[model samples]
Target: MTKLISKTIALLILTSFSMLKSQSVKEILKQNGSFRKDTIFSIKSDSKETYLPVTIIKGKEKGPVFTIVAGIHGYEYPPIIAVQELLKEIEPENIKGSLIIIPIANVESFLKRVPFVNPLDQKNLNTAFPGLSNGTPTDQIAHLITKEIIPNSTIFLDIHGGDASEDLLPFVCYYNRKDTPENTKRAHELSVKLGIQYVVSYPYTLTSTEPAKYAFKEATQQGITALSIEAGKLGTVQKDNVDLIKTAVYNMLENSGNYAVKKSKTVNQKSTVLLNQQDYIRVPENGIFYSELKSGDKVKKNQILGYISDEFGNKKYDIVSQTTGIILYKVGTPPVNKGETLFCIGYNE
Candidate 1:
């Protein structure tokens, strides 16, 4: 009996020590001044799961949380590369607030080189923000982000660029809602500090029934200061564009009080407020498309921008600008299909 009692006491002491070790591990995770990388997984459906690589760098001193996300459209390469580089270079000791970077938000789309939508559910991830848990795969991912990530962020940045089939000039976008005037101003200020050449303001409209589902739109609605930065072009990763995006991100870190870099004055950038009736020029019939006008070109109303022709060099139709504005993006490829968007024109006024 004595021997058995002694063995039981030994087992009890080991169990107590194990509990203490577990508690210590938890405490270490809760402490600041370390960088943590986690692969977060979300259930897309009954049999499918999607994963996102998240990097969290916490500073020694407590401050606000800044969230940066990229790769919403898989073919936008520069933003993804910039985010990856940021994750590698940021040091927890040099930061004041925490930095949360999601390098690839849509992993499957990125791996498959899908352009604008997720392959699993065929939904545009950008338009499915604050999504439903029981919805499609893209929707589920957005829902997980809204519930798990956005609430923790004091400021948010959604990085994007032209997809594989688009050519665009770099621009920054922010929501301008009358109800959230303070948040709107903050977002605009952040966009200016982002060091982009063009700032686009997306004002809220009551006539449209389409819900506010864009990533930055949802975040702004939640009173989070958010800006969307766009760069790169033609679905290709240019080194200069990648560096430009990286610099913008660093500028954002400095503006948000996360980094210790010297703050630069907000540069004078052109602000373009998109009119409600902006035109998306679409192809009337299938043919080969040829365009002389590139993105960022000033276009007058009813001006012929390009033409679609038959295989035998017969001109089928002429693509014209509907508004006196600038071309935000033009189709990068020569192939045309019926109803495909050929040009996106933003009004000058």
Candidate 2:
């Protein structure tokens, strides 16, 4: 009788363990042809877990998996709004592949109205890609994105805009790889399909180091087709800019055969090749920068783009264009620091 009881107890324990495992394996977005929202925890504190919002939509028919991320800088409001609106409009039933949308990647920075870097760790999320698991809060977020989110994606899109202190034009960027010609070609096609005003290609030969540091660069290194879309300006959330970003995303979805929408005509825009660091103009000293040149303005080499003056207007430094190209973005804020970027010039190759 005792032996029989022991066998029954052992069976019950095994059954219980099986049940727990099954419960844990339940997919976050279990229903096909539907959408569900969840939280991806990047940091865990004593009291609560800091997480980013993740929306997963599984299609009825299996195809590719597209990952869309925004709000990396927190102050870029247009991309954040665009992704939020996209989550509402995409229907899983009409999609052919999975769609993962991270509307706001840095919630703490967004809530605090921080600009380029996270206030908690003072780290720029963009530069901390493929990050360390036990690093700072920003690093942990990057690590989660690189490991948990990006690995499941076949295509990746990172949306950005002019931060609180930047004024910029609409542009798209893609990584160019000589070793992976097919991936580079696909990324270029994706950039053109985005239908932005301008497209910039970052060649892999520019740096000899590992290319797994920047968000899009890291995705490209992982064999994922990735593109970065830039829109809006000065950190303001304009409805038109938001609509522009949303339309570009829809274009990609249609072009990729994931969304059952009207096919968008691919419009090829002018391409700007950034070959070196000299493409950017940096400030020489701390002062107040006054620039009349806005983004998209064409300027000649050695042209006076702006001028920096001391607080009392005593000493002044002239900012000039280093290359004969169109201004991609300029500083919107008045204050400047030594070695800070004042403007980025984009030229056709």
Candidate 3:
């Protein structure tokens, strides 16, 4: 009789736990606490009919809140896959902290498979940051992400892939310049926990000054940890890379004490080149250009990088490197325009 009573109590406890687990992410959003959902901004135009969906997954267990944002440029689908796959693996019972995921930060851009170039205002969604309250549609989207999504986050991972016209090698980024002692240490620790092979420290460049920059930098300034990760290309979805990133993100949450998964391999920030000094070589003039060097090739100062010729091939201008470095990325598009970046070169030193 006593044994039967104990078994009944155990079953009751398990049933209660299962009931709690069945609560949807939406139900979690409506709860009162440090966690609540508010639309900090919105974009509604006649031509574009969609809303930028942001979810705040704030765990009531009193731990860190990490935000994962993607699809800022629409076509970057691998990160979206990563976020969705991650959501499936996380159990509310195991999560001690919060995880806010904006799988498609730019919903219209994702639907169109194009970067949100503000149709009416002529602005890129990415370039419009710290977005004003009364700004354009793109600006409002940026404002929404910044105001609603970023404030409560203790850590942020803004995942992206190459924009249109290029494919990227699987890599992760933690801008070295934005790191404080706390953030730098947090980034390094998270890098190890994620277990992605190539751990790079991106320096503050003009490229780093936009899009995720304001949120990442602001998160750091607020003593929060932030890292940006990029993999694959604009429209194409690399399934393997997506799976790898999903695993890494899961491992990170596990390490952060939010999930009960096995720990991942710890990686060193310095093991890879961790290029902090980087620059892009832009096309000097409009021409039919041919690049002799591919991505990841090393070049010396003044080396023959490529050649540009007119339509008839009558005259050609040789493009050479001004510095010795590794080619991190090269534009995949042809018939290049003057002032458009052709190659991203990073110095090891």
Candidate 4:
């Protein structure tokens, strides 16, 4: 009798342990301190051995579902750090909504320290949207994210930064001009909460072959409030930008009623360059670049804006502004080809 009782107890304990281990993330959502790390997709190849893991943190109360994705380019570290810190600080007990954080969306490229492009096919993961199940590896990954990861989201924040080729001033970017009022308002509110230097609003072609096919544009189409945030330069992590992103994330969560948190201090946008109807100046030839005026400088029509030169320092071509405007952006690299975008001019009127 004694042996039978001991055996029964052991069997019951083992069964309970097995049940706990095999519980799905959805089942665990019932618990107060629930947090699940799910492998959304897997990359299988000798050249790349990695998997994209998504961490889902559902708050106790019923509220909105916000999905924040980072490391789309793998080299943009500030946004990655920002989202990871948000996951760490989030208390499920106090949360009013579900928060999903995909810290390393491009795990393969992150391990290789390059942009998230397939080594075998050179296909950018971002461009593969509404993807196929049995297509290329990137397509499968994109499909998994679009189907399983993004659909349940009510709001999305896709973060990025300038890669190895360029440096980006901290900015908030949105692609809905005025067609979607709710989404545009939500994006603008988050940008204001972030207190970034620039809040740039633009539009996309809505093409499936574009690089941002699965980005904020897709989210907007699905009725998800989304914003694309660029923090700092790529490859290296900047601590100041990381802090800024963390604070902004927390503020957004609080404002969204996900947590009982303090509001971010209001920041007046006094030094902003409100750009609209901007024009791009194209380079006419391959040459070294020389700028007569800096970005944010005001100029009149027919002004000598900049020039292009050869390696021996002989001037190749002179660039003149076609309208009265402010210089918004200029390319830094030299030997720019003909028809290459050299700079952007923003008109005041």
Candidate 5:
């Protein structure tokens, strides 16, 4: 009950974007422009701060307001690099709609070399949606994105992937929410149009931003056609993953009839595979995890995916597959904490 009250309070106390020093995104969109990119700071303290590096490209013709956000997890490097490539791929004259590109969302974590959480408050930026303005640093960043970015976005992509400790299968996923608005359908369609082959269907039960908890989910709740992509692995910037992200975004912009897309080395997969259910196996205790499986491995029901042992090397639990499916992502490293995700199985019925 206390937690519920706190959540409700946080929802109501969503402060305005007073932290922004430059013109707001909507204000920038109001003007016809060749292109404008700026860094909006989210101030934490006298000496601590983070920033959103945003690029705005308005088309000659009017269309959707597309927003691409990357680097929610600091260790996800490919998505960040992909956004830079997008800054080049998207031309103002050819774009029918405007493009808002955020190359790095968690700048502090990226700069500090933090893995999953922000170095400011040790909080996961991706999990905090519609955050409190007067709260922690992560919450402040979330609030900044929610207030400034989400409102100006008609279509959204929150790109993320494996952190420094995980192995992730490259795939794009759309929210599978019940009784969602038209945004849900459009999001799924766009995920298919991304042309990356594997499309995972993730279930989301929330309908509002306060409870959505994820960046893309918050946008989805706000009636924007939003989805996310998982690529890269173990905090390394793989060229293939970076290219995959760039090509996928280009395909989306091309399908939108807005941007001038260039054909290069991007090979579209022959067919799209629809994976269902976001089956994540999380550990319940602090232990050393052992898994030989990689992302995309097929697993049978009840099969031992891995085992968690204590510090003394005594096995405490065996991580097993609850459903038969393909692994979308898995912890590649051995460190396993309480309530940490071990594997996410993407199943098909």
Candidate 6:
């Protein structure tokens, strides 16, 4: 999309949302495509404040409202950078509908360099969905997302990478269940069409009755077609991972017939399908771990993936895989505390 066309679309969006002023989700989504960025602000004690940075763009043509959320775990860097690149790459003329881009959802976590949880209130942002307005900082941010972002999106993606302690394989995950079979099918199709060879089906778990702690779960349970992507690893900004996410996302939006994106060339890759993630192995006790496997490695049931030893090396116990599958993600760093996730295994059989 050229600059002139882009500006025209922006004008259209601005004109459409001319009466928009409030921070209500409905009002925010109704506005024009002039590439507006808004901050969802939350006040803290002592008059201090934190905010979630969000960019809302509406194309001239209306189609699926595609949303991309990153930086939920602040220490996860690749996805954070990837979303920025996507922001630069997208042109309004090419996009058919609206775009909701969250470059960094956990602002304090990113600023404070915290992993997994928000540094301000010690809450996991990912687990704070349908958040409380009167709750902690993380909760406030999550609440804004649940209320302002997730519900309005037709096709949603909550992007992430391995946090500081993780070594992860790149894969996309979508939900499936008996009760919401239609929702599950739509989500599964989006995941498969995302162009990532490696994919996983979310184990049938979350229900409408449960609290929507996770962003992806929150979206999925609402009958929206949503999926989560894990591409980067260990809080590092790797270029391949960033490009992987950008390309996958771009193709996803384009293939949906919602975007008129024209690419210079096509990326060639092997095709892969969905695998079911069956186990999330956690550390039994605080210890130094020795991993015998890396991400994407295949394993058999009861296979010894690694071991944990006490500081003095006096006591040790093997961390074994309970299923025959691929090591989707594992604790990449040596330090392992009790209850921390050690491995998430996925399988085809």
Estimated TM-score for each candidate: 0.83, 0.86, 0.78, 0.74, 0.89, 0.89
**Per-residue lDDT over 111-164 for candidate 2, one digit per residue giving the tens place of the 0 to 100 score:** 789998887778899999888788878788888788777878888999999999
All-Cα superposition RMSD per candidate: 10.0, 9.8, 11.5, 9.4, 7.8, 7.4
Candidate lDDT (C-alpha), each: 0.77, 0.79, 0.67, 0.68, 0.81, 0.80
- The sequence of per-residue lDDT tens digits that candidate 4 reaches over residues 251-281 is 6777777766564444536565444456778
List model 1 lDDT by residue over 1-349, tens digit each. Answer: 9999986886575455334432221233366555654444444466554555566777877777888899989989999998888777777877886777778988879988998998888889998988888987788878867766777788889999889988887777877778778877877777777667677776666333444577777777677888888898888889877887888878878877888756343443555444333578888999999988888888998899989999999999988777888777878888888987888877635
Model 6, residue 266: distance off in Å is 4.5
Off by over 4 Å in 1: 1-33, 206-210, 263-278, 310-313
Off by over 4 Å in 2: 1-35, 45-49, 206-211, 263-278
For lDDT, candidate 1 versus 4, the one ahead is: 1
Model 5 clash number: 0
**Model 3 TM:** 0.78
List the lowest-lDDT window of 10 residues for candidate 5: 11-20
Q: Residue by residue across 120-203, what tens digits does model 6's lDDT show?
A: 778898888888877877778777788778889998899999999899999999877668787778777767766688889866
Clashing pairs in 4: none
Candidate 3: tens digits of C-alpha lDDT, residues 1-349: 9999986886675455334433344455557554434231235545432355555655557777778888777777788777777666565555667778777777656755664354445566666666765666677777766766667677788887766776466666676654366677778678755656566676644343444435465555445677877776645788876876777777777767766546443343444445666767888888887876676688998998888889888557888888887776777655778997788777766
Better of 2 and 5 by lDDT: 5
Kindly give the number of clashing pairs for every candidate.
0, 0, 1, 0, 0, 4
TM-score, cand. 6? 0.89
State the RMSD for candidate 2.
9.8
Worst 10 residues of 4 by lDDT: 17-26
lDDT of 5: 0.81
